[model samples]
Target: MRTTTRMLALFAVPALTVTGCGLFTDETTEKMTDVANSFADALNADDPAAAGAVTTDPPRAADTIGTLYEGLGKDAHFEVTGVDKDAGTFTLDATWKFGKDGHNEWKYTTTGKVDDTGDGWKVGWDAATVAPGLDAGPLTYSAVYPEASRVLASDGELMTQQVVTVVNVSPGADLAAVANLIGPISPGITAPSLQSDLTAVQGKPITAITLRETDIAPIETQLAALANVTLSPQTRLLTVEKELASPTLAGLAQLWQSDADAAAGWAVRAQTAQGTQRLAGRDPEPTTDIRTTLDLGWQRAAESALAPITQPATIVAIAPSTGNVVAMAQNSAADTQGPIALTGLYPPGSTFKTVTVSAALQAGTVTPDSIVACPGSANIEGRVIPNDNNFELGNVPLHTAFARSCNTTMGRLAVDLPPEALTDAAAQLGLGIDYVTPGLTTVTGSVPAADTPALRVEEGIGQGKVTASPFGMAMVAASLAHGSAPNPTLVAGQPGTPDRTPPALPATIADQVKTMMRETITDGTATQIRDIPGLLGKTGTAEFIDDTHAHGWFVGISGDLAFAVFVHDANSSGPAVEAAGRMLRAR
Candidate 1:
């Protein structure tokens, strides 16, 4: 009776579970879990086709999964959480990473069904299997970038986003009509030039030019009316004043765009019959404003000073007390030579006398009151050094010779100093030193060691092998005004990093140099426009190609401002001095 009862119990258990849980034996349960895991493995591998092959319907599943994966930034990942054989379902954890660096993530748990379907176990094919309510519509990922931040100067905004019209000419468009309509407002856009440009591009749509809103408003309608002409209004970072143009603006705009991109918000969404619904991602944060050390008033003054000059000219001004770049202005002629204001190298000429004198004083070669011979021309170690127009001062105080820009005296003084004296002094005054300044690429003047007396004489007079940019000369003047070289800066909060820290310029030495510069304005070569109050300057005439032609330079200090003016091929220091006067008076 016991054996018969046990046998009956086993049969009864199998009969009761046969239609439901009973059908899924250990083997069947393992197979189901295997199928689910295989599907997850394929998805994690980013192989949509392989993942779908394990599903009940391959083609439909592959296509749907591919679309969803791409829409989710193509960085999707999947994990099989659990498998419920009784319910013929499996749980999956889905994670999608977004953005250029995949720093953003959207994770969720989804459920899918698995069935034998009279063959082997396979995941049920459905868009819902990939995501909850995903069958509603197509999936998409998008980024909502915050508005570009404004570039602010010391006083106010220097650059802001504004609408600009882009003029595009399509294939077979009437080039003549486009040129005639655009040429008047846009410089350098003519019919023949447009034809040549279009032809070179294989008749593709040519983006002729981008015009500011004010410049394009009048002709917007006319341009749109022309066939194959597309006038697209786009947002661009532009200067507040239309006439305000500078190479610095381009760097500022790049920084602005980078800031905006970094603050961008991302969203994983779907377009459904009901409407667009966001699946994941956070709202974009507001972009921070970009602040520069530039002072708009000073910039305008510098620009105005160089406006009438046809030669390549620039003005670089710095706040001596803070080492902040207050203004940088370049004329159209200077613009053609690139950002020469900051990077172009030219012989600093007599401007370099400042360094020579400083080195002489530091080396104990001469005192400000010491009498020195300022011959019209002097031969030192086979090098002939001459003052401008061979001007001679038989014997005078060192300060008087400096004010007069007596090259002969400076040369003799330099020849008496150590080889590295001038190089060290120039570094102390910020030249001959590399500064990694933010928002500006600069080549400060280079003062190599004058290892020989001839070279020293040449360098003393700011001649051979000595080169400086306008920006560099400004720093030299700033060093004297501030009693030490300040760490130059462009963007606020970002001070420059010098490659090497030089010894500080002594206060006494700086004071003596400043005195000489003041005398230059009061009683020397720069006396022409010395009427401007509290001005201290040094005038320079640097020979380039030959003695007949030279670049003019003036490095000066006025109140708290220190500036350098450079005029390419100006023949003498007169133009630079004149420009400096105009800049100072305007301030």
Candidate 2:
């Protein structure tokens, strides 16, 4: 409760009797009470260090204005106009001040953590609650805005996180964020995706998503934009109702057909993708409990922040804290684009060195001071690799090799760790497995072969079958950030019950890997961001998927968030390295 000066009357004005033991004055109380007030005096004098010496307890992130009150009440500036004692109690009357305009003016009710110091009054953890709203302040971190959130489901149970969408219902949330969140809520929105499946004429695709059967909630405004969006009846048919367009609505059928083409397209006859056990199409699946851990603000930020110059772009941000996906977007006129960055199994480009390097160090095969050549290209395993600067040169330290992103050097060292050890390391970081995440779009990069130690060398360098989603790679970067496995996401609520992922690699190992990443940023391929504070990452450009498109990737951390981005089938003709570098730096 709020123990304040005003509320003090309620506690003492004869209605209630004190319940604690009889008051005893101790020397400790007198000493502390004086100390608390002294700390307050220090704060008033703008001496933070002096105030800290007395009241060392940290304050809550939510105590907006109470910062004035440190160990005791450093900022508790209520005027002590006078002190009164009667019937074993003490009362003080005073006004407090805050702000240059002297905007804050109020009386405070308080209870002191008092002890009789062989002397008189002393202070304990005692304090009073100031009046509500009287201490008006800016909001701290809160999740209560009208933002869009994503939730995932399987077997009618949510599998991800409570990715609440705050702005989806409001005006101006990113279109990409709304679309991703739309992954779950269609049943209530009348299955606009299905309404979209009808064989009618054309215009822009109209679709809706909502909560289970009911009038549209304000959240469905965008879905409502599609005239075809509507909820299903008790049967949960999730039907698509079209006006049975005349030949007059020339383009309606084309629009209707577009949604039907999707794997998630609403179908009137078949009950398949959300499959069954006893039967094929007859099994029932409900859209109840679907959710995701997607954060609305970051999702919107990721979407609006990306702008591609005639080339396709993919971004995947996951909460390394839980593998909660924050954002996934394709910057293209994508009627048929796939989520390749997270699902496409392309060579890790140069970023694979982050993992390979870890494997090497864990094996005790390399130390920080070990030396290797700063070569442009080198041949091993009947294959050739070239460095970006193409200047195969003199011996350099292992740290320099990482900073330079030397493929030849990493390829040689990848063989240092047993192939199985390297593969296990990848799995520990949440790679080489079918994504436990929702959405049919998840693609597990091909796992490294256990039988071939020789192949592990390239795999260690993020080549071979080491393909990963941008999210997965981002996970790799985050793992380096935390020195452990990172769980990430882009949705809200439980997609299903959470499973304890195996813990990250040993902390010491994670630490070394992180140091290597930092060196890379300081003097390697990632050096483009060398001066940017708190940036640690790896850059890769590999010719793997097909001869036509060489993939370019950047994975790193800035502040608390981690990101994995890709330039798919990036036309090698342009400055892919420079472009990818610029984009990665922006993040």
lDDT of 2 by residue, 85-144 (tens): 323223334344332343333444543333444544433222232222212322121111
Clash total of candidate 2: 91
Model 1, 1-587: lDDT tens digits are: 99999999999987887856655477777888999999999988888899899999999889888888767756878888898878989999988888778888888998999999887889988888887657877788888888678899999989999999889888878888888888887759898898888899997888999999888988888889999999888988999999998768877787888888789998878889989988777888998888999999999999999998999999999999999999999999999999999899999999898998899898887899999998999888888887888999899999999999998899889888888998999999999888988788888989989898889989998887999999999999999999888999889999899999899899999999999999999999999987998899999999988577899999999988999999999999888899888888886
Model 1: how far is 521 from its true place, Å?
A: 2.6
In order, candidate lDDTs are 0.89, 0.50
Best by TM-score: 1
Q: What ranges in model 1 sit over 4 Å off?
A: 1-72, 115-123, 131-134, 273-275, 545-549
